[model samples]
Target: MEQLKQALTSAPVLILPDPERNYVIEADASDQAVGAVLMQDQGNGLQPIAYLSKKLHGAELNYPIHDKEALAIIIAFKTWRCYLEGRKTTVYTDHCSLKYLKTQPSLSRWQVRWIDFLETHFHYDIVYKPGHKNKADALSRPAHVAAIQIEGMNPLLKGLFTHGYTIDPEIPLAEKRHLLQWDNDIAYRKGSMKIWVPNYPPLRQLLLEEYHDVLYAGHFGSNKTLTGIAKHYFWPHLAKDVQKFVTSCDTCQRMKSSKQKKAGLLQPLPVPEQPWQVVSLDFITGLPPTTSGHDAILVVIDKFSKMGHFIPTHTTAHTEETAQLFVR
Candidate 1:
């Protein structure tokens, strides 16, 4: 009676018929090698159940480095689904990323489907193992490379094993040309072409009276020309006219190039701790003589903030006069 009570009170562990009945699966990157060990417990003792390993279907991508962690999760799930058959299982992988599976905010469509399938079909736990300890899974990596070569040689087998479908068709030349021309707006000129001057009063007045002055007032680049036209003529007469014309300007698009200048490194001020304590002095030499007979400007800048002070002075000014200018 005491023995029965002791057995009843003790924690229970459900044991399988043969030691080989327990499912252990491993997935690795090398060759998509999936390994399984099934254990069963006999009344006599735990017995060697069944051990199986196989190269998975599919060629390895040439750049498998980025997708290694994703592939590991997929192969691990596939092996469990294929062989475990209603049995609880443990899957081991080396990818740490899978540890946050439940909390990941975004996943690719393929990953979403994989997760859904895993949640629906299996009750299992994913365990992380270091790469060196996961030897059976490591063996699968080489198979991926060989599979790729084999698929490349055989088109029929390739089609049969490929993950997605493809279609190819031909279109008539005339139809292709029409499709190519559908959205094209660019103008082309080969020889001399007649320029049409608009008969509208405002546009004519703008071209005849204002265009030359605006072009000559500053640089005649297309952007500046367009801006001048917009400010003086287009903005006053038409609603949203500047936006429409600017959007279609091919000259601006072709002429503009992006320029990035490196920033100057910050140097500590000579009088490091005090503000406005240090200054730089220089002269603007060879300046045209001013009406006051000054030929150059003395420039001084605060080293800390680079704020400038310019003072007009003559080249012939004596040191005493320069000192007076500085004092003033």
Candidate 2:
């Protein structure tokens, strides 16, 4: 065993990926972190190609074991997408349930997303590897965990959360488990990370506009807009506010087609007492002109009796001539 360690350590630690060879990944997740090791067999059995580790933040730290395990694989793939995009990769996981991840009958919202990305970009297989045998186990169990309150947020928007939390009394201080204070901002705990929106109307309105009224958001209807915003923000009557905002969106009203059709006029014509009392007149032109210069047909129909008459006339016949024909 000591000779094996000496030989392995004396050799190169990390290797460059070879395009001709396939890759193997060993992934593991602890309570607060996830890690993965990418390897390939040049001539010796599975040598290390790269290593990836991510510290969990926000609601990620509270995910179940299987979800954490799944997230580890997703982060590994994302981190080394260029290395794995068009390769045949085999993944080893300590979580046995992950072997059936692709075939699982049901999945969470995030799971579906993770699976979608994996299935779309890479050709891969999941295999069950025991925790003790997995090298990633060490990397997954980091000794110290740092506190990252918030990350990768727009500066102007982050300021809004701070301002609203100060003045808006609807949300309590970070006393409750569901609510948290991360440096300059307060957040709500819903499964993943959701920021607690205050009662301030301007802040709430800005959120609604970003999720619904923005050009990239595509002016989605109330339900979709509500779902999108609710995923990352919280406020009282959020659904109702989204409904009202979408309904009043002038651009949506102008661009979107109404589902209801235009109403037709319902007034009925007066029933004729006599055959010729109420007659309808129409002209069907565009015929070949005859030797007598006649090239059109005048169609007359009586409303009450449903009687009809067809009289031939010139395409440009005088009104007096047609009137004289009708009188005769």
lDDT of each prediction vs. the true structure? 0.47, 0.77
lDDT of 2 at 76: 91
lDDT of 1: 0.47
Cα-based lDDT at residue 30, candidate 1: 39
Candidate 1 local lDDT, 81-111, one digit each (tens): 5555566766666554565565689876666
TM-score of each: 0.31, 0.41
Cα lDDT tens digits for candidate 2, 13-66: 667789888889999887668899999999977898887888999999668667
Please give the lDDT score for candidate 2: 0.77
Model 1 segments more than 4 A misplaced: 1-22, 31-73, 76-85, 141-328
Error of 1 at 174 (Å): 62
* C-alpha lDDT of residue 265 in model 1: 97
- Model 1 clash tally? 18
Clashes per model (N, Cα, C within 3 A): 18, 0
Which run of 10 residues does model 2 get worst, by summed lDDT?
Answer: 141-150
- Kindly give the stretch of ten consecutive residues in candidate 1 with the minimal lDDT sum: 186-195
Off by over 4 Å in 2: 1-11, 142-328
